[model samples]
Target: MKSEELTGNLHYQIFGLRSLYNLPDSVVKKFELHYASLPDSTIAKDTLLSVIINRKLKNSPYIFLRKKDGEVVTIYMENSQYQQFTKFKYKELIDNKQEVCIKLKAEKLMGRYYKCISVTSVKIKKGQTLGKQGKFLLYEYE
Candidate 1:
């Protein structure tokens, strides 16, 4: 498949919550110290603060720290799945000269943080004929 040819919408979700426990021991120790340094407060306030911090930290787009490591990783929806979208039905849309642009939300892995990223658009070649077959594109962000 040509690099510029985008077959369908990209669907991705962040997995930051899962990585909290996966951090190195040293990182965990640092987090513990930071947690304990917070000011003393009533139980409700403390719980609220903890919840807010946890959500903020986990929702940050810097949690995908692991590399592919030669393993097949499936981050977004499969090609078969994407092909099901009517707008991306290759045979009809491409044949009719319609342009397909899909915006996808993704996550970037930075050290121990997961950052949110976006795939703005994937465009198939103009005037290029498309068949029922679809292609996949893997994107990486810094």
Candidate 2:
């Protein structure tokens, strides 16, 4: 699909969440968690926050939660229109227990030029993309 199509799909997902959960756009767009806890707990919280933020930046279709047991949990936001597109890819990776390669493309306006970019065949690590260029890291399931 085209980049615009992908972006539209993501926006649809975001708006769907707002409608389904009755959440304000601000809440859906970003989240923060504060804890009053121990050192290890703080570390875990920080790790989880980083993961979520990275995923958001990458335009990944799923939200991840890292449990105290160190297991990463995938939560497909039900309202996301792109959930089906992402779920299938994730399932394939999980079923095979193998890494899936991905490509990322982005465009930026630099002065008078529109610079189009591409990064290809990046690896997935810890359920997130490695070496992909973007704010959010993409992931293949499993």
Candidate 3:
């Protein structure tokens, strides 16, 4: 039946209940533990990282995060809208010999690599030009 017909259907609800009841106990226990901590796990997935540009790779859309305690994180901007925005600001900061701190929400793409989702804040020592770059840094998703 169509999803519209399934709404408030007693038979559909019973079928779903039967399916769950037939599931293996091991699978049910795993589901319980995994879903029980969803709220906590979700919060850590989108981490807010404050980092400066280590250096921009030659002819690449990735920027490596500065090493901290020998750990280097790659920032992937290839598919993100703020690619140019990040590069421009990074160049400005480097030229002025100023510290650049960017707060962004990112998720891991691979080993020691992260895909920048949205930039929350960018702080350059003497930057004021970013205010005119539109809302390229801000992004909201459902």
Q: Pick the candidate with the highest TM-score.
A: 3
Could you arrange the candidates by TM-score from highest to lowest? 3, 1, 2
* lDDT agreement with native, every candidate: 0.36, 0.32, 0.38
How many residue-pair clashes does candidate 1 contain? 9
- TM-score of model 1 (CA atoms): 0.23
Question: Of 1 and 3, which scores higher on TM-score?
Answer: 3
Q: On residues 1-142, what C-alpha lDDT tens digit does candidate 1 reach at each position? A: 1112122422222322333333567886886687777665633544433543544542222211122241212222323323323244434554686534343444422222222343445564454332223244222111
Q: RMSD of candidate 1 to the true fold?
A: 14.8
Candidate number with greatest lDDT: 3
| Number of clashes recorded per candidate | 9, 2, 0
Better of 2 and 3 by lDDT: 3
* Position 6, candidate 1: lDDT: 20
* Model 3 collision count: 0
Instruction: Assess the local accuracy of residue 70 in candidate 2 as a C-alpha lDDT between 0 and 100.
Output: 35
**Model 2, runs deviating above 4 Å:** 1-85, 88-95, 107-142
Candidate that beats the other on lDDT, 1 or 2, i.e. the better one: 1
> Whole-model lDDT, candidate 2?
0.32
lDDT of 3: 0.38
Q: Which stretches of candidate 1 lie above 4 Å from their native place?
A: 1-11, 14-19, 42-49, 52-142
TM-score of each: 0.23, 0.21, 0.35
